[model samples]
Target chain A: MLEARNLSVRYGSLTILDNVSFAVGDKQWVMIVGPNGAGKSTVVNAVSRGAPYTGQILLDGKDIRKYKSTELARKIGVLAQDTPVGYSFSVEEVVGLGRYAYSGGMLSSKSSGDAEFVERALELTGLKELRRQSILTLSGGEKQRTFLAQVLAQDPELLILDEPTNHLDLVFQKQTFALIKNWIEETGRSVISVVHDLSLAKAYGTHALLMHRGRLVASGEIPDVLTRENLTSVYDMDVHDWMRKMLSQWEDGQSGNLPV
Target chain B: MKKREGFSLVTYLLFTLAVLVTLIFCVCAGSVSVPVKETVSLIWRAILGAELPQSTAKAIILNVRLPRVICVGFVGASLSICGAAMQGLLRNPLADGTTLGVSSGASIGAILAIAFGVSIPGIEGGGTVVMAIVFAFLALMIILSLAYKLDYTLSTNTIILIGVIFTMFAGSIISLLVTFAGDHVKSIMFWTMGSLSGSSYGNAVTIAAAFAVCAAVLLSCARELNAFAISEDNARNIGVNVRRVKLIVLIAVSALIGVSVSIGGTIGFVGLVIPHMTRMITGPNHKKLLPASIFAGAVFLMLADLVSRVILSPLELPIGVVTSFIGSITFVYIFYSSRKGRG
Candidate 1:
């Protein structure tokens, strides 16, 4: 389990992430959702130690700041958005780099126990076919898959993803969440993801944290936190009516062309 | 996998042999050309403590060419490896000691020694060497910290622009020193242009020792460098202690650059061109690229130094002139070819 207490992040004169806190239990897929600039990504940054924040982030009851980087790496992996691959590294090479923590040091390379993990990641992400292909030549969707496979190879206890499917196709988005869902079910792990797609979040998450303008407006079960009233208040819109209109377009027998 | 390792081992042996052959050839073919056969035989006999016939060729090879060649080899290796390591660490293809202004910063200290006739007590080129190192560290830290503050991803143009500005700043300081040197202006100017003419066994040994230690440290961080080649944030998320690795790597690189600049002046382009060539031939895996670049760099510099000495015959051309001439041309080609549209 992981928990954050009174987490706050300030950028000199402005506060990016106001005092906000949440917890994630084992095997729970917790979705943090809100409009743009709601500090969703900031929480992920603070949790990953990418940004400095005041307050305690505990993993297994120990402060995350106290854990060795390698120790924390074995527990948490992040697949961030828009991470560029500069060189012409092959998909396999990029995926294998995920085994760096297991490599035992910054310098050493070990493949003894990593081949299987990398192979599985490749297979799961549908990247096995492109393992030898240069990452530079891959499309955005394929590149996203490459990075996702890399995080999969990391094999962390808690996977943190921030809009990880931004460049992915709809099918890949489903596959990625399903893959993480399967991993959580099998290993009893957890995932904390910040997603803007409400339907995707509602369909996959076990719990939800709703944020607004750097504040946590609501938190609880997916259904309770995403209530029409809370959504309307936070978004300043008729959230249910908008959703109904979008869903109506996909309704069966309306177009008489395909089943929804 | 076993086959691959064996294949790499053979390549390494072949590369080492090439470096050795180049070293001997450089020793043999100088202004006073010593025959290759005689050069090898004499070197072997000398190593075994056997007396050789006293000849002009033997004297030239032993007293003049050998030390300069050795110094060139180590300086070449250090500069090339430092360039490759930095490119990886900073996640920018354009990154190198010369481009990053570390070399220019280092030359300032060397110039200071020449202008003021300053020498630290009991240390050979003590003031120059120590000052070169201090200024190199200061320059590298300034560039890295400022780059970090300005851009999180270390964009190619931004970092290089910063380095360009830093190099200009250091150049102005050197110009100021030269203006006041009075009689030492020629010496300071010549040092900035770079030459291995005054090289001695002491300088070669110091550079070799520093190169060995720093190469070991950089080689140890190959994985971290590989992670860094993607992005700093990605490196951190994957468990690399970005700050720690960056500190260790930059310090080692700075020490190597300081020692090289102090001993051989500020040789340009060998660092920039050699690593780019190495990546093209050997691929981007630092595990292989780092070692390959070191060997390739040593050989390339020895050849360049030879060209510098022989191209003008009796009068010597600055090694820096030779390298920058070739390096700038090659860099333009690489840039237009590989990074044409992507950049």
Candidate 2:
């Protein structure tokens, strides 16, 4: 279990995240959704030690801050929306780098049995053919998968995704999410994702943490946390009615005429 | 683009063969320009017995050319390794001693030592080497820190601009020292121009040992260097101690550059050109790139040194001038190809 107890983050005198508390249970795919300033990414950054925060982040009842960065890396893997290509490393080479922590200390350029993980990651992400291709030459979706393959090679129990499919086109977006869903379901691993699309969150999340202006507005089962009142209150708009109206356009029962 | 995954054994063999050929060719074709057959037999005879019917050709080959060639070879390898590591670490192709200000910064100690050697007294011999290494690393840290402080990303423009500024600042200090030295100014100015002349086996062995240790440290960091290519945050996420790896790489690369500069005096373009060309062949994998740079750099500088010695016949051109001429052409080609690739 990963629990955040009264976690808060501040930059200078301005508060970014305020006393937010939540827990991710086994096999849970929790989605954090809110407006632009919701501190959703901050929550992920705080756990990753990218940002300093107050209170405690407990991974299996131990304070996360106490864990070394590499030790912590073995527990949490990140797949961000856009990963820049710095050079022309081939897909496999980039994926293999995820095995860095597993290397046999310093001065011994050896790793014990990591090829299996890399191979499996490559196969799972459907990048076996592109393994030899330079990452810089790959298309955006392909590049994202290469990074996903890298994270898969890392083999963390808890996957953290920040707008993982936000920039992808329709087919790639579905492909990416389906892959994530399969990885979570097949491996029984959990995920903490910060997503902008409510429909995606509603379709895939097992639990939901709703936030607004840096505070936890609500949290619990997806259906409960995403109720019309909770969403409307936090968003300051009629989110449910608006979503259904948008959904009506694609529904099977929709009339083939303008709404006039 | 279709690229081979790892550098094949064929490439390594070709490079090794090329180094051997170049070494012999360089040794033979100098001011005297001996034939390949004669150069080989002379080397063979020298190895067989220390004492021979000593001739001027033998003396020039054994006492002069051989040591200088070996020293220049190691110096080339050291500079190239440093370049490759820095380029990988910074994730920028144009990053090296000149752009990063390390070459000029590290020159401070060497310039001081030459301008005021007897005054410092006790630690002239050993202290010069240490001071160069220290300044090289310090310049790197200060430049990186200032760039990062200015902009979180350490953008290319910021780094290059800071490097140029740092070079000017170091140049001013060097100028002030030159003004005060009066008589020593000529010697200090010549050394700053950079050359591989006056090399002895003593200097060659010292450079060879430093190259071995420093290259080993950098080679060990091949994986970390690969990680750093992605980005610092990503490297950390993948379990690399980014800070530690950065420190280790900087220190090792700095030492490599420092040792080369102290002995060879800031030969440019070897570091910039060799590693980049190696990367194109090795596909940016540091595991292959670093080793390949060793061969490529050794051969490149050896060739440059040959040109410096022979291009003007009896009156030698500065090795730095030869490298700069070649480096400019290579750099332009690299820039054009890279931009074209991106486009």
Best model per TM-score? 1
DockQ of each: 0.62, 0.51
> Which regions of candidate 2 are displaced past 4 Å?
A109-113, A244-260, B1-14, B45-49, B118-124, B340-343
TM-score of each: 0.95, 0.93
Which number leads on lDDT?
1
Compared to the true structure, candidate 2 yields what TM-score?
Answer: 0.93
Q: In candidate 2, what are the lDDT values of residues B1-343, reduced to their tens digit?
A: 2243346898889988998898888888888977788777888888897566567777878888988999989999899989899888888787888778898877887778666672335533555677778888888989999999998777666887898899889889888888988887876676566888888887788789889998999988888888887777788788887878888889888887887888888787788999988887777888888999999999999999999999899999878898878887987787687668778
Score residue A235 of candidate 1 by CA lDDT. Answer: 90
Worst window of 10 by summed lDDT in candidate 1 chain B: B1-10
Clashing pairs in 2: none
Instruction: Tell me the whole-model lDDT of each prediction, alpha carbons only.
Output: 0.86, 0.83
Residue-level lDDT tens digits of model 1 in B34-99: 789999998899889999888988788877888889999999999999999999988777789899
Q: Supply fnat for every model shown.
A: 0.73, 0.78
| lDDT, residue B140, candidate 2 | 91
Q: lDDT for model 2, on a 0 to 1 scale?
A: 0.83
